[model samples]
Target: MDLQSIKDPSFLKKMNNEELEALSADVRKFLVEKLSITGGHIGPNLGVVELTIALHKEFNSPKDKILWDVGHQSYVHKILTGRAGEFDTLKKFKGLCGFPKMAESEHDVWETGHSSTSLSGAMGMAAARDLKKENNYVLPVIGDGALTGGMALEALNHIGSAKTDMIVILNDNEMSIAPNVGALHTVLGRLRTAGKYNWVKDELEYLLKRIPAVGGKVAATAERIKDSLKYLLVSGIFFEELGFTYLGPVDGHNYEELFENFRYAKKTKGPVLLHVITKKGKGYTPAETDKIGTWHGTGPYKVETGAFVKTPASAPAWSSLVSETVRRLAREDERIVAITPAMPVGSKLEGFASEFPERMYDVGIAEQHAATFAAGMATQNMKPFLAIYSTFLQRAYDQVVHDICRQNLNVFIGIDRAGLVGADGETHQGVFDIAFMRHIPNMVLMMPKDENEGQHMVNTALKYDDGPIAMRFPRGNGWGVPMDEDLKQIPIGTWDVLKEGTDAVILTFGTTIPMALEAAEILQKQGYSIKVVNARFIKPLDEKMLHELFSAKLPVLTIEEAVLQGGFGSYVLEFAHDHGYQNIIDRMGIPDHFIEHGSVERLLEEIGMTTEDTVAKLKSITPKKQKRA
Candidate 1:
């Protein structure tokens, strides 16, 4: 069977269970081989092969909507819908998206990259379908881990209560990014191992009826006894209570089980929750054995050896630097506590968790809860370090504004991956945090120029006891700079002058600092004296320095690896305007549009944010002749 020749899932209608199983095997092989070169969510995709096949075989896609919750597991869906040939360029620039894209095919009804959004999206689509008097099934395949999300639970409440005709596929794999936690995980754990619920219930009812009701008497006592025992054994009781027709503990790998449950779900009226048990990384040995979620996604690997492609690190990752520094600081400060929303692995907080198990918290994909939970700790005079990715923190903006900032609580937010986060595309980009965080009152926002400065800033943020503060750090390794032997606190709201010049000033920080330095050196070689300033504090503009630049009437250029509007550049411009300094200024950054998936360097080049562009912008802004007296 040529996998690449697959045009659509329509071909699945004629195929029997044996053929579908074969197809699943073929799909797994294709994914394992293809993704070895171009890395992706191989573990998740491999888990869903049979389930996806059975879905297409049973239901009509494009017409019958199948919404993948996070979309990382939609690779099998993509291949069945004629995207197998595109695997070579998957997640590359101008290539197949890593997540479901509505633009890619009509089959992709609901586009999603974030978790727990599918049910809500499904409800909207269901409502629209009813309004238009159209009949079709809306199945939202959500993970057991996603059910912990506040939004998903809300949607479940609404959809169940409303008696909407839809199928909520509960794909229970015991993992999501990392191993799931909380009460929901416990419930699902019971559900996974709980044997023959109906048979046990029948046996219990039979025995209870036969046994005398010991003084209480009759069928009412017997019924009560049956009810009590049923809940303890029945996993579907949770879904049934929520008004969904509880269907399975179906084996996701078996086409027969998947097809049988999916059929039952389709015929059933109202909301049907088909609890399908899946094994994450079912086909491959290495991924199957992955315990720490290292194989959730990857950057290329060896197919034969299952080893990751080589990239000898020159420096510790930015996440490691920030998290390790916090762990070091925590040893001395008993008030310090660490929290992440299901990103202990991603944030490199494993060491912290290992050392301070009681002090560390893995909140499990609840950003809003994590934010307020950290705030609650802050109220107790406890230093809560809320480590969250910049993109995920957006979901908790209200908590950040209302609970954290309004109360003037001292919470240190480690804004991880705080720039254009490449391959994960626009959904995962950490570009908007500065724009959103700076405008909030009593918020101190900053980014460090290098690994040394990053660790110091981490120290600075933790020590600061006034209101809320955040330190944004980029993805991947640092510049291999020597770390200071002792942790030191940088002065709040101060900027560092990297190079001093009288003609023109280049204001930049974090990832763009090197670009600014390179651009300035190039300009100096071309007989122009240029000044480079590390504008570390984003919210508090270097006003005194700005005043000096204004008095000198030096042409200024601001560079940032974020959106130009409402960004660091805008902050500088705002300061200039407030003081009424009519200075010639130019801002270089990502424009008002969303940047797509690509290598960071390529994305920077595409947005004209490279050293060459910086030099060009500098040349255009500065006066031709430098008369240095």
Candidate 2:
């Protein structure tokens, strides 16, 4: 069958087990070929081929709600729902999204990108269905890594207590971006060894019933035997204890096994947990052999060789630059410890872990826990460098405020991928970090102009013992700038004057600095002397330097690659108002709306964060200096 012609999962109901197996092969081929060109969540999608097919066949989507927790694994779901033809434009601007989008198809019941949301979403849907007195099943497929999230655990407790009519498919591949960590992984490990307990228990029950004369006392003994079996088989017995009808250790790839378990789960009442074991990269050899999660999501790759097709690198990645700097500093400072919330690979903390395995900690997908854990270490006089992505840091906002900021602890936060992260779409963009972090008191927030400045900032952050300080960096490699022989601490609340001008001043930092420079050059050609200041420290505001600029009465324009509201620009405006400067001020940044999937350049252009826009904003404020004497 042509995978492209697939209209809906309705076709799967007509096919036998062997036919479904053939369909799975075709779907795998389609994904490998398509993702090689467009680049996407290839490993996750490939792993769920059969499982997704089984799910679609067993349940009617759009009516029977099937929520995917972390929509990266929904590529096969897309193919089954008549989206195989849209592969050419995957993850591109105005193309099929990399995650589940409700607007694309009715089959996509819930949109997702962030982890550990499906269970809660499913519970809500189930509640709605019951209120309406409707007959519909709700299924939420969650990964083993996602199951460890604080939100997911909370949802499990509520769902079990309510006995909500829903099915939870625990898709355990033993990884979430990086290899699994913490006690949950160990519990799942024991569960993996306990094979088909449901079948074994059923057989035992039938044998005991056939023995006749088993009554009262003998029946009570059978109950004890069943209770003992749960303890003997599944080490945790976690789901059963939580008031869920525990169903599996099912082989996710086997069509017959999947169908049997799906049928059983459908017949059972109350909440059911169908634990399915899968391989992260099931079909592709390179992704299958991957142990460190390089293939989790990626750029375009060579199909035959499985080699990535990337341009030659000019400098080290920002994550490597920051983590390696911390690792290098750790050699001298025994107090420096590194922590990541399950992103050892993404944050490039492997070197730090390898060097100081005792000091380094990888706390599973618990961002909230990771934040306070760092705070605890800070209280003990140990410098904890919590390396985490900007998008994920949102999960720990409460901890950041109450625990770290309120206490005024000396925790160093390495905010990785701190600007517009392209391709993964709106849910994964890092635009809101500065806006959220800047408002909190005693929080020192900054972004580096380049890799050299980044290393220096890392040194500054680790050395500072005042309060929580964060240094945000972009996703890709640095600009290959020259480095100094010795490390130095930049004074807090300072800005670098990259270009000197008298007529106007352009304050910007991080990814937007290059464009600001270009805009200034364009203005210079038009007889306008525009000053460019690297506004590295976002919070402290470099007040003394700012006063000098305001006193000179330069028409100031602030630019940042972050949310406009409560961001760097807003801070500058507030300072001017408080000082009664009356200097003509304007601001540019991400608009109030969410930015979707696209290349970084394209996104910038779309949001008018370009040299032309910057020049236009400046040109509007200062009219070419009136061709001075």
User: Best TM-score goes to which candidate?
Assistant: 2
Model 2: residue 522 alpha-carbon error in angstroms: 0.8
Top-scoring candidate (lDDT): 2
Pairs clashing within candidate 2: none
Full-model lDDT for every candidate: 0.90, 0.92
Q: Where is model 2 more than 4 Å wrong at Cα?
A: 199-214, 218-223, 626-629
> What does candidate 1 score on TM?
0.95
Task: Encode model 1's per-residue lDDT on 1-629: one tens digit a residue.
Answer: 89999999999999998888788789989999999999999999999999888888899998999999989999999999999999999888989999999889999998888899999999999999999999999989999878899999999999999999999999999999999999889988887787534345446667767766565465667667766766766764787788886766888898877877777667778998888999899889999898888899988999888999969999999999999999999999999999999999999999999999999999898999999999999999999999999999999999999999999999999999999999989899899998899999999999999999999998999899998999999999999988789989999989989999878999989999888898888878878899999999997877887899888999899998888889988888888898898889999988999888988888888889988998899889887965334
TM-score for predicted model 2 compared with the true structure: 0.97
Candidate 2 local Cα displacement, residue 55, angstroms: 0.5
Over 391-439, each residue of candidate 2 has an lDDT whose tens digit, in order, gives: 9999999999999999999999999989899889899899999989998
Q: Which ten residues in a row have the lowest lDDT in candidate 1?
A: 195-204
Question: On a 0 to 100 scale, what is the lDDT of residue 148 in model 2?
Answer: 94
